[model samples]
Target: MIITEPKPFEDILEMLADVDEVSIIGCGRCAAASLTGGEKQVLQMADKLRAHGKTIVAEIVSDPAICYLPRSKEVIERLPKNGAVLVLACGAGAQSILEVNPELLIFPGTNSRFLGMTAQVGEYHEKCTLCGDCLLHLTGGICPLTRCPKNVLNGPCGDCVDGKCGISSSPFIKEEIDCVWALIYDRLKKIGKTEILSQTLPSRNWAAKTYKPQSIELSEEEIKQRGR
Candidate 1:
């Protein structure tokens, strides 16, 4: 899931400061799962905006999650196109709204954190960075590229200070990150696959790290044939 966190209300208010009539859009998928931009949050936001003296023209928790282009487009088409729109979803969903309505004033209400998984009700773990490379099989099902702060591929950096990652700051590594290479080593040794680590991984293809647009196109005959 694309994990997200709610932006501060003050920031949201500032974004909508000049606008009178506001339309709110929420995601029913990842944002809802993360407890940031779900239906309940949308209503709460509406109430808060109204209290601050902003006219609410619409509040919608998109059933199709606001990122699914076609369905979200259909939903957005029916809303009153006025003033500004506050989207409580990930960056992708917010952009999707703009793609559907290019002229509408749209603002993000949440911050896209990472592509991760839910560990509990309020806990999320970063699983992947979408690095466009897969070496999990060699690393015993762990992705060192993302888990390791240094993105070490083949082996440990040999500079870990007591098995903790080297980065810690407000915008970077927040918590005491365990050395992912150490984890990989332990996992490989435990599984009797330590030999795999000896084989060094080639340099990552930096070109593959870009966002490549994709689409699915099927001919009428192909669709009809599949119906059988």
Candidate 2:
């Protein structure tokens, strides 16, 4: 799921400095799971905005405001003509609403964090880095691109001390973080695929990550050619 965290209240207030009438937009999917843009958060934001002397025009909860253009339009229809929008969803969600109505001033109330998996409530673990090249088949399903601090693909950095990553820049990984390569090594050993490690990985093609977005779409003719 997409992970998002609410921006600091002070920053949100600062964004609203120019707008007096506000419409709040919340998310029912990713941002809801992160507790940053759920129904409760929307109401809380409304109350706070009211307290701050802003007229609340309207509020709507969209599951994935990013993917649903018509629903975003419906949400916008509830707002007054002069109201500005304060989006409590992730960056994508806020942008979705803006795309629907470019004339409306929109402010993001949350920061889009990462593509992550929801663990226990209030806890999210980063999974895919969208590196474009997937090596999970060779790495026992563990993502070296995301799990490794160095994003190493060939092998371990040779900095493992007792199977802990030597990268200590992350303050959250107190003491030591488990070495992703070591875990891959152990899992490969158990599965009798240790030989897979012997093969050299191709050098990464970073153009996919830096340039134009890639899409997988089949044309109508191509689909018909398949005889489906």
Candidate 3:
């Protein structure tokens, strides 16, 4: 699951300030789970925009799995004849909409948050960092990348107060807390293999944390061969 919070209304207003007519687009898949940019949210946002004296040309429309499917074109086609769009989907969905229709002015209505798993109902936390490598089996399925505040691979530092990370002041272990490491420890202890924590882990690749646009290229010959 992907978790996201809606961007501030003030910021949204500023982003669409120049546009006279606005159309709110929503994704029914992931955004619906977080209740951010789904049908309900889009309608609410449209009403809010109307209250702000903006000419809302149409009601909100939500598509199922807009990010992975090409059906988003239908929604785009239904957008006001000549109005800006405020997309309420993940970053990928927003980008896809823009790619499909470059003429349409698109704006993001929600922040692209982390790829996470639902800890419980209505509670989602990041579980993977997509670091180009995975070491869940070695560490008992606990990803230090997302679990540890500092991305510490070795172990919790001395500053860990009651299992909470000192760096971010995040609670270490709560009464119903879902600490992946703690869960792994408990499982290992039950299996009589509690010494797994004693094993040292290799240093993490800091390069993975560096922000860089990764791209793949194909030669002209290859493109021609593939009939591109």
- Highest lDDT scorer: 1
Residues 84-129 of candidate 3: C-alpha lDDT, one tens digit per residue: 8888888888877776677778888999798997676578778787
Candidate 3 structure, TM-score to reference: 0.78
Q: Indicate whether candidate 1 or candidate 3 has the larger TM-score.
A: 1
Q: Specify the poorest-scoring 10-residue window by lDDT in model 3.
A: 173-182
Give candidate 3's error at residue 13 in angstroms.
1.5
Candidate 3, after superposition: displacement of residue 163 in Å?
3.0
Better of 2 and 3 by lDDT: 2
lDDT (tens digit, per residue) of candidate 2 on 112-202: 8999999988999899988888879999888888988788887688887788888754677665788899999999999999899899888
lDDT, candidate 2, equals 0.83
Runs in model 2 lying further than 4 Å from the true structure: 70-82, 169-175, 213-218, 221-228
Clashing residue pair totals per candidate (backbone < 3 A): 0, 0, 2
As a TM-score, model 2 comes out at 0.88
- Candidate ranking under lDDT, highest first, comes to 1, 2, 3
Clashing pairs in 1: none
RMSD per model, one decimal: 3.1, 2.7, 4.6
My TM-score estimates for the predictions, one after another, are 0.87, 0.88, 0.78
Best by TM-score: 2
